[model samples]
Target: MKKILRRLRRFIRRLLGIKPRMVWLTHPVFLQHEPGGSHPDSPERIRAVEAELKAQNIWRHLQTAEAGEVSDTQLALVHSRRYLHFLEANQPPEGKIYRIDDDTVMSHDSMTAARFAAGAVVAAVDMVMAKKAHNAFCAARPPGHHAKSGSAGGFCLINSTAVGAMYAIAEYRLQRIAVIDFDVHHGDGTTEIFKDDPRILFLNVFEADLFPFPDLEKERGSSPNMLHTPFERGASSLTFRRRIRNEWLPVLGSFKPELILFSAGFDAHRDDETGRLNLHEADFSWLTHKIVQTASSCNGRIVSVLEGGYTLTPLGKSAAAHIRVLAGKGRGVDVMRYNRRLKQRT
Candidate 1:
């Protein structure tokens, strides 16, 4: 009887160890039907990462989910109704791109894709709140950080992160939410939308003098709720990690955020063509670990969304490492599931 009880105890602990914290994956169709002629923001970005996740064997632990279309009412929480109307009504000609300014473009499926991407984030919020998983990641495209309240830019139509933050606060009554954007480019859109609100803390780290270069040091939001760390070209991962440890982490702890959202952009990777930062696959994994540790202290609520990582090899490898850490899968495990819900969605 003693031996049997010991074995049962061990079994319970092992089962608890393997249980997922929580993970959500967006559908592949979210990438399909874009308007550009093979732009960097193509479907291949998510596909490569998905393949690597499967190759890593980390995919099995994540719960699969579909990104439903966000309602206009929810979208209006962050964007203007007029702008939303314009985006829905104006569809670009097939096989041609309609520029939403100089940096953003629209294809036939852009609207639907954007809606689903936003919806995926909302689903993540729901899952986290329901305690289905410890945290979740939204692997959708047409990145949202650079999108503004009234205009679409930087290949982004809707600010998915912003919309998710709003949903958490308004719908779920989560106070003291925080958004940490690690994209190589500043999240100007998220900043613009939440500048006046004190309920959220928007922290960003991006390359200095990159696209949408106007958000420099003097660009203060309506509240002291914003912080920016602009690194020069060739900034090393060590330096980046130090900033997080010394600067960002302290502030985040003090804030005691109820929920943490990551604008996870791999464009800062060394091999990425978008920026000069020299981050590696290890950097993404370490950063994810740090974020998870931080979230664990606050009831383990985290949501990571795909932002910008263009190079196929680095993007796939880096994203795989990040997701591996998120899923609590042991390192070096190849063959992960691409979309935990892919089989169901099909």
Candidate 2:
């Protein structure tokens, strides 16, 4: 009787110990909506990262979610109704491209995929807030940071991260949200949407003189809260760390945000063709550690959304490192083996 009772307690404890990490994965069908020839924002990028994660055996640990389409009502929380209607009504014909701007384009499937991309972030916020998982990572494309409330630019159709932040505020009643965008390119659309809002803190670090030119400085929003750092081309990991230490860390520590969101972009990788920032895979690992460290004050709440990473090797490496840190698997600790060799290395 005593042994059975002990066994039962052990089983219950094991079940309770399961800490699932949530990750939203967009379908490869999202690739079918390509707008132009041989673009860097291809479906192959996500596929490659997925394959690498699977190879590392970390894929099984993630709670996978198929992102659905976000309704106009939900999108309207951030975007104007008129713009939403225009996007829904102007469905581009198959094999034909409809240009929203000089750089943004739409295809027959672009709208549908964009809706899913935005919806992924919204769903991730819900999952984290509901305690379904400790945190989440949205793996979607047609990246959101470039899309404004009224218009799309820089290959983006909908501002997914902004929409997600709005949903957290309006639906989840979450106060004091923080958005940290580390994409190589500036998140102009996200900045534009929340520039005036004080409840949200938008911190962006991007390469200076990059696309969507004219970077952000200490511009006071309506609520008067924003931070923008522009780094020169070929900036090293040390410089990256210094800027985060000097600029972002203090602000975040002061804010003590309830929820943290990361616009994770790997274009800063040295191998990426789109940007010239010289960040290696280890830099992403270090940054992830810092973000997680910041989130610890808020009980370790974080949601990271994939934005851009053009190259295969660096994107996969950086993403794996980021996920590893988020999962608490890369803290110089090995869980699979309790051997002397691994223990000594750590």
Candidate 3:
């Protein structure tokens, strides 16, 4: 009955000239990657985003799809085979967790979840490039920006966005691609992988003196392809927006990329303590609109993969705001008021 109703809904939308604008991809495995012991990157992050979208009545309007299965060949495009072998060979025993580093841990199901996370981005790229949807959002985690080609860190196991970018270049033969990351922490791993590659233009906007790259200040201008823009702690929305317009937009416009990919991380939200930045949902919505506007030149192709947002409430609210814009639904939720209501409930 549910399947029939879904089909009927699709038909009715088509008849009414309501074309679906985006696809949302996720997987069940993402929920099982428990890192244990007070980890902020919990499965509840995904749940929070899901619950918020449903509450906002946005879920019903999206075209939900399962994550694609990424194979060894595709993963090797960005990662080494030996490192891949090590991950599979080193799966912890049942009920035991393996620590990759001080910040990264892997339960038995971690690799499986990581694979699917990368797969979700790959699938999104395919969907957007094929014009099946104007854009796509993959809600899979453990986040991947801090992950290197050979080593995992910052609770990341695979560099999913890098994998997806490489996949697009290989499969579709795209000469120029833009990878834009707005996470609070520098996308050091991604920068390392693509620093020498002229085909990729990496625009990274991150906070200065953060984890994994306290020395990032000295490393600026080392690579021509990778442009690093650092923001001081507690940067205001105006500063961020102005810098993006004055600094990043010109480079993006000049490149005229064939495909655009985003490493979307909401940890920089004002309410999320981890990021310590004063960005609200409105800021995120504004950025999404800018990205959509840029996509106008490239057949409106975009694939956004989730990165970091620890606080459940703001994470959900911010993610929903971004997705709603991507889905071509003008914003309706007042994030400040919604947060106040939740506090009242509590």
Candidate 4:
């Protein structure tokens, strides 16, 4: 009812003409966490995204803010005490890299960067909650979807989506919050974190056969509130659309989330070899539109966090497409400029 009133007011404002708000949260502190030496999850990913948005001229429309580091209390929202200590204990000396797991690594500044990345998401939630912005995109690195409570995997550390969602529950006193993950890999960490909580609905659509293979049956996440739509390797745009239209939308409608969060991963793009899915820029644009429409029903609030998108060219292009839709730019992606930017990088 309140959302209806807000929309009515917006509709009235359009008669006088006022624009909706969109914000982007990022920081140089996010740049300080590089693992070095051919790491796919390098800080350069953020640079690529930043440069692309500027090259495409979409940066002009976004309100930009630097993310503050997360408090210890905020870290506890989703991480264990031991895990917190582990990140601190495992930090490598300056100019060195510490391998946390098979694919996860940390440097002297890793903990700080991870905190800020997670903090950026929490801050995005705050922005939407306080109406500082209608929607936000967090282009921070070292993606969090694969981080478990006490373990880091798939280049993730603190499970930022979980942190942000729990922060919404505890800080904003919100129930029925929904987290949607469209990364090429399943958001196993996020699913595990909210497994027992029916109030926090988790929806994931990832490539069916991918890395960090957990028991598929076990990953049903102990509740019907959790929905997983896994697609095979050769899955294309048609199947992705079908799943979103048929599988995700129905559940999302019934859930009626007060706020929505996206684990926006561009690695699912066909141009990205990190994961083998045939999604294109149009697919990313389409997903964002659907999510935005869903958010409209819930007061037009969304917080999007960067998860996975290894290949730079596709990552930049896809992210720009996603942000365009988020910024209400109507699928406006500068593919020619993105291509030029990629060529310059090579």
Candidate 5:
């Protein structure tokens, strides 16, 4: 019955020439990557998000695409050739796991999965640039914000967000692109990759004294293009929203970005044990809505890539809320269905 109703809605929209503006990108290799030994960056993370989106009946409403693998040459745009070659050369045996650092590891198929994760972002950029979609969410695994140009850290193998940003600049000649990261931990890798590039503006907010780089809290005022907002432990929802509105929104409006890429991390959810900050699903919806309104002024193009979300239930719920707003679903139930019911009653 649900499937039938969904198809009916699609058919009616087609008749009215109403096309969806949001695209959801995923790849099977995301599940194939094994980080090994109770690592928080698990395949189950993507599974949880998928299940929730479907459970909320949000999955069938948008266009879905399988992400293709990124090419080595394209990867070289942001990553070092030596690092790319090293990642290519170091693949563990089928049964073994290779540890890149204390926090990151690689299984036999990890490289393939990493390439496809980056590929999802690349595909999303192409879709939005071509105006095929207003925005996209890449739900692939092995998050990329932590991976630098030359090395991997904090479970990221390839810097997929950087790849997508560079791809947009190179392929579309876009200037003044914006990358906003609201993850629990600092996006040290993204900062390192884009700190020198004047074309890109990187805005990041993370928990102070958390994992990765605690010193980033002190260096917040150093870079002109890079803006950092570090929250102390147990920061509340009010603090989160207030800071974003005060700090991120003004800069975003003034920058008037050609494209906005979100490192959409949900680990800040209060229930998630990975991060100490406190945020809820409603906050995420509000954030996405604000981003959408900002995008409305500048061609309405956004590409959101998943970063860090550890605990299962909150991760799923938070991601659904974010995707819902991206799909223009708003904070309430589906508006189309509500309209149809009202018409029937009338």
Candidate 6:
């Protein structure tokens, strides 16, 4: 009876031409990306996010889809054949853990998780391009913004948003696409890959002196498609919003990208221990509103893939704010509660 009612509701919505949907992509394989104990980035992050969204009943607003693995062709969109070969060669055997760096570690299943994480974003691009859903978010891991073309670090193994943007450009023939990285860390990997490609606008805001930090500032390429806004540690919400408004909004206004892909990382939240700069759920809500508004003006298409939120409590709260906003749900307690929390923390 419940299933019948759901089907009937879908039919009615279709009949009414109310086909708005915020598709969320996740996969069980994402849970297999355990880096080790005491690591900030763990499988528990996904669990916490899933539990909160379910408890809040936000899933009702989302068109949840099981994410798939990225095809080799899709990986080829961003990663090189040699790099793919290197990652495959270094993948750990069953029940074994291999450490890539002081912070990055991979178990046997980590490769699968990384591939699917990137694939989830690629699939979200397909869904948006096909109008299967208005916008989509991939709640997968390990996070990808920190992963470079030939290397992975900062708990990231694959550059998902970068790959998805490339897929949209190559497959869907999208002329201009913007990748907005609000992960509290610079997306050096993404900038590295798409430095010279004018087809992409890689705009970001990150806390200064963070991990996987890029030595250079912005893209030094031919067409100039990248912008970086760095914040000092302990920067308040006012500073955060002000800089983005000044730096990103104008660039995005002019870029008029056909699609927007977000490297949505909530690690900047005040409660998160991984980073020093403080942000809150309300900030995330406002940020989503800005991005949604921008996308709406150009083309109502966005694909947000998970990147770097670690602290479970704040991660869940902030991600809920982001996803709910994407689902067209108004910001709830996040508007005031998290703002107060942010003030307290900072």
Q: At residue 275, what lDDT does model 3 achieve? A: 88
Q: In candidate 6, what are the lDDT values of residues 1-346, reduced to their tens digit?
A: 7547756766787889988598878899988877778888888888888788887788778877778899999898788889888788989888889888898898899989989998899889888887778899898999888778887778888899988988888888888998999998888888778887889888878887887665543333333788878888999888898888887888898888899999999999999888888777889998989877865654679899988888899999889988888888888764767667666876
Tens-place lDDT digits, model 5, residues 130-249 = 776768999887898989899999999899999999999999999989998988999999998998688988999899888885586467677788889999988877788789999888
The C-alpha stretches of model 1 lying farther than 4 A from their native spots are: 1-21, 220-222, 330-346
Looking at model 4, report the run of 10 residues with the lowest lDDT sum: 333-342
The TM-scores of all predictions, comma-separated, are: 0.87, 0.88, 0.91, 0.89, 0.90, 0.91
Cα TM-score of candidate 3 = 0.91
Alpha-carbon RMSD, each predicted model: 9.1, 6.6, 4.4, 7.0, 6.2, 3.2
lDDT of 1 by residue, 9-84 (tens): 5467557875445575687667774746557887888889878878777676666666778888889998999999
Query: How well does candidate 6 match the true structure, expressed as C-alpha RMSD?
Result: 3.2
Q: How many backbone clashes does candidate 5 have?
A: 0
Model 4 C-alpha lDDT per residue in residues 32-53, reported as the tens digit of each score: 8877768888778988998888
Off by over 4 Å in 5: 1-16, 332-346
| Distance from true location, Cα of 297 in model 4, Å | 2.7
Clash count for candidate 4 is 0
lDDT for each residue of candidate 3 in 1-346, tens digit (9 for 90 to 100)? 7558856866787789886568889999999898995998999998899899999999887887789668899999999988899899889988999998888999999999999999999999887887666788999988998888888889888999999999999999998889999888889889878987888989998888788764664667788887888888889877887898888888887888888889999988999868878888777777878766764666668888999989999999999998888888877658546446545755
The lDDT, on a scale of 0 to 1, for candidate 2 is 0.80
What candidate 2 gets wrong by more than 4 Å, as runs, is: 1-17, 215-223, 331-346
Relative to the true structure, candidate 5 has a C-alpha RMSD (angstroms) of 6.2
- Candidate that would win on lDDT: 5
Superpose all Cα atoms of candidate 4 onto the true structure and report the RMSD in Å to 1 decimal.
7.0
Worst window of 10 by summed lDDT in candidate 6: 214-223
